[model samples]
Target chain A: MAGINEAKYMLGESVRMLKSGKVSNLISVIIMGFSLLVLVIYILVTLNVSIIIEKGMEEMCVYVYLEDGVNNSITEDIREKLLEIESVRRVVFVSKDKALEKFREQLGKNSDILEELGANPLPDAFRIQMKPESNASVAMEKIAQAATGWKGVDDVRYGKKWVEKGEKLVKGFYMTGLALGLIVFLSVIFVISNTVRLSILSRRESVEIMKLVGATNMYIQVPFIIEGAIQGIVSSLLAMALLWGVCSFAGRYLPGLGFFRFEGVIGFIILCAFLGSIGSFVAIRKFLKR
Target chain B: MLVYEIMPGEKRIIAGVYHLSKVLGRHFALQDINFQLANGEFVFLVGPSGAGKSTLLRMMYMDDIPDSGQVIMGAHVSTMMKRRNIPRLRRRIGIVFQDFRLIEDRNVFENVALAMKVAGIGITEIKHEMTNILTRVGLYHKRYEFPGALSGGEQQRVAIARAVANKPAVLLADEPTGNLDPMVTRGILELLFKINSGGTAVLMATHDVELVKSFGQRIIYLQDGKIVKDKEMLFRGNLRESISNSRVDHRAKKFTEHSIGEDYDGKRGR
Candidate 1:
């Protein structure tokens, strides 16, 4: 019962303190919101770029071309060998005629050029699709290398140069993203902690009075921590709102850009609230020790 | 450790300092300071500027620990008490400052009630207790006024009310009337006396020797980090005889006509 009463009093004190520093609190929230918005924007950009890269990877397939005049039995044997590979999910045989037809379709308005030179010059091929989990460039390279040495196979290609280069670029992006995310996370903590310190310094008199009157450190700090959490919630919500606005505006030029999921948004807000409490805890502990 | 084992009986000494020494920087801020305060006894800690009066009171409240020796307040010992227990000791003692350190943002009632609130008293009990305390300080009507709205004396009264809100055993005042006019000073002193009469010991520190001299309370004179004289202890070893509740006004009347410092020193020299 006493604990309940103390909690009620702490909450009342937090509300009272928040009300007293209305202008300063609003300014702090806005500044924190803008800072948090920078982080959200960075995250969204990274998320969308990764998604696009993943979609590109999903569409990629390794193609094994048979030698000219290869019989159906030879092609069937090659296809069976390709299907035996653990990474290969499905393999479809494209006949010479079907390959030529695909070439004409790809030419669209320029199909006349393709028809004039065609004596069904295209070779039969096996299009190998890997499982999503096994679609990494390294796995594709291994499959392509093994198939190139097979009998009756002219060449096995998975666009190795493009795939390897793209993989490198994606790796570099993730490395930079991780480093930048850490810096942004640390800066947010620093900003929030310093803001709380300033707020506490402004109310130093009240803290001193509370100490002199025999108030425990816990009693004094609970209210400030609550205020910090409220600040965190308000600032993060503002950040999310601003991010939505930015995403909407940017969507005109970059359609199909992914935003945060509902769970992810809720998680971000909760993480921010935790950060706020941690900032307050650090700041108040330092002040009280002095 | 063994000394802390001895507990005070009813009406016995409630606070004391024994061979207390504190060094600030290279110089000794307080050296070999010793005094004892009986229950319901009012004492003036008289000294000039830089005489370590504030330092001594701070140690009594366990705000600063002694470099050597110890301070005993109720059940807490400065050297032995844990840092976490300081607030508990503070709740048992009231402290008033010269600058009237009231929270400027809070009104008088809220300022006083904060003490109770921190102590985890229910709102109903706080309201009940606040009425009696504010009425005692003669600020019941002005409870809603902030500290800035109150005069120096009124602010000090509010501080005192807040300090004693927990009904502390002793009130430590470090030049509480330093900024007040003489007329206002007397009023503040009378209010302190009234609280003292109701069984709260007050140890008031001041540089104004003349003002506290005629009060006829036990006076501890400090100079350059040492106790030059402890009046009652020096001449009258029995503290009860010199500072009985009934003899306060009688002693005040007797000391009003003479300079007690000169008279006492002369007798000591002889």
Candidate 2:
């Protein structure tokens, strides 16, 4: 009955209470499954969409073409200046010959058409990649203004409109996901609280006896919180399993559906545990009063 | 050290109720009820069913707060207590009930052990104290038996063991023998008297006026939530011997006598 052993025993007793409340716990877990399912689907959408957006943003780069009859030295100077641009992450020069080869490869089996042409029509250009965090349209305008006024520079091009739209969509998606996630997190806590409340209610006599015998609120609360947390934990795991099954089945027809990593899944599970503990804590607050 | 000697005639009150008042529902249960229990005092609270003895006892243990007034246990004054300190206060006091109130899930030893466990007593010490208390109550052999297997009298013994396990400053018994037969009641009262002799102030609430009168000790009788009488009685012989010669011992002696004689009669008949 020393502090450590008493605490250890109380934790064990809480686990026993959860496991022994077969019908009630099963009902709680099922309710939790539905709640977590809502939460997990939201998390999955947010994670996968964020990954796709990151990949797309990585490809949002600018292409700067050089003037006709521009010499190699000027092209080198141009590349060095392009690197100085704040938004310009990297600059790769593709010569006339390499450009033609790339074009031929893009044409696939129609490369004979390019061979029939008397001279290579491809221009010497620098493929400019912007910084990952660079504003799409703003960076495009800056590079355009800088390159157009420079010697031997012809034009600067980037997919400014689409990239800007994508950024907006990503921001909106995250805001909505965050709001929805908050509501569902609170809902999950409520469910856990109800489950823990019922368990405490069933063991009301024990609580009274414990109070009579000098148990502090913390001592009485540990077991109920444990019961609720177990419910939260099991429910979240169930939601994850269900989500995994759906994703695996969907992955056959929809690519990138199963993009969630282990860390994301672990984070969700930890949140579920939090919801359970908080929920039970809320439920037992009134009972602890004198 | 001279605090007592300076006022040599003053009694050191270990627990007392000062002008205690309680209201249940629309009616006042207890009003201006004043009394003190000094160290080692064995007092009887004799009252009818609705006399608010239970309410007064609950206030003593802080199970219920009084509408007005204070309950003093040792140095603790209930009215001014900080909420966090109630558990510490309860630890200094022990309570026994008419129903035994032993946790059904635990066996006899565990029932007694819980009181000490809540006080964070070590497991070895809990076991040792439990053995001592259970042995004193003649229930050491039933230590592993569940309350369901115990008779009402044996269950009451387990309750007594639990209450006394922590060596509380004050022990409150509210109808502790109400559910037991006369013989068992005599044994329970004797155990209580023995505990009182060990310097634990005992305030027992019962309706058994004859038994209360026989104690020749301080008695407080409540009627309509008011203390009608608070005085000492006079009786013959010692308190412990009175219990030994009470109806319980005579019946038990007769029962043993009948068992031996019946065995001889059976052999002769055979």
Candidate 3:
């Protein structure tokens, strides 16, 4: 019963504080929301960039052109051998006629140029898609080298230089993304915690009076912590809402961009709430110790 | 209603200091101080400015621990006390300051109610009890007034109400009436006496010797971080036995002997 009464009083005190410091609280929440919005925007951009990169990686295929007049048995043997490579995900055989047909479709108005040639110039090839996990330059190079040595294989070709350059670019992007994310995360925490500290400092006199009146440290701290958690919830929701607005507005120009899933949104809100409470706890603890 | 561990053979001694000493910088703030406050006893701790009166009172409330010796307030022994238990100890012991120390933002009722709330009392109970506490302090009509809006004396009354709201076993007042006028000082002192009569021991520390001398209550005089006299012990002729320290007892006796012949009629002197 006493515990219940204490909890009631603490909650009431929290509400009273929130009401009394409405302007400051709102300002703090706004600042926090803006910071979180930056983080959300950064995260969304990274997410979309990674998705696009993955799609580009998946489109890269190694084409193994067969020697002239290769027989069906020889083509099957070459296909089986290509499938045996660890990096190879799938192998599809494309005959010369099919290749020429694709070339004509790609040419469109220029199909006459291809038709001018008496015989088909394209060769039957085994197009191998590398597994997404093994699509790095080294793995692509190894697969191409192995296929080039196979029988009935005239040439094995992939955009080896392009693959190497893309891998380096992707690696650099991820490294920069991680470093920037960490800075934004730390700065947001710093700003929020400092806001909590300032709020608590403003009420230092009240805390001292409470201590004098025999209020326990828990009694004094619970209200501030609750207020912090509330701030966190409000700011995070505001950030998410604002980010959604920005994404919607930007979607007109940049289509098919990804947003955080339901679970990620929920997880982020919970994390922010935890961060808020921990900040209050730390700030209040330092004051109380003195 | 928290259980208090009674030191063996001194059940009536609700609070006391035994050979307590505290050093501040190069000087001794308090040295080998010894005194006891019996249950419901209203004792005046009198001294001049910087005589360690506040320091002694602070030790009684466990705000500051003695560098040597011990202060025992019911179950709380300053030397053995845990940091977390300080609040629990404070709940059973009320402390008032000269500045009143009321929360300016809270009204009289809310200010007094804060004490009960900290003790985990329900809002219903606090609302029910605040009226009686305020009435006792003659401020029931000012329950809704903020501390800043009230006069110094009225603010002190509100502070007193908050201090005693928990029905503490001991109330420690440090210059509570110092900021009030003479008429207001008398009123505040009368309120304190009324509270003390309700079975709560009050140890009031003040720098004014003439002001407290007329009260006829037991008075302990501190000078230069030492007890010069203990009136009750002096009259009881057990100053030496009570303090048990020959040096402190000797000084108390010497001082008491020097002033034994002075007329101390409570009304005539004032």
Rank the models by TM-score, top first: 1, 3, 2
> What are the per-residue Cα lDDT tens digits for candidate 1 across A44-159?
99899989877787767899999999887888889898889898888999988999899889989989997678488888888988776774788888888899898899998888
Model 3 DockQ reads 0.64
Candidate 2 residue-wise lDDT, A64-160, digit = tens: 8888789988998999998988887888998888999988899999999987888988678999887878776788878888888889988877777
Could you say which candidate leads in DockQ?
3
Better of 1 and 2 by DockQ: 1
Predicted candidate 3 versus true structure: per-residue lDDT over B1-270, tens digit per residue: 233333322325567799999999999999999988776567899999999999988888787889999987765678877677677777777899999998888899999999988888878888888879988999999899999899999999999999989877789999999998999999999998878656666899998889988877789999999999998832333322233333322322222232222222211110
Candidate 3 docks at the CAPRI level of medium
**Lowest lDDT 10-mer window, candidate 1 chain B?**
B1-10
**What is the DockQ of the complex in model 2?**
0.36
Q: Give me the displacement of residue B261 in model 2, in angstroms.
A: 60
Place model 2 in a CAPRI quality band.
acceptable
Model 2 residue pairs with clashes = none
Consecutive 10-residue window with the lowest summed lDDT within model 1 chain A: A1-10
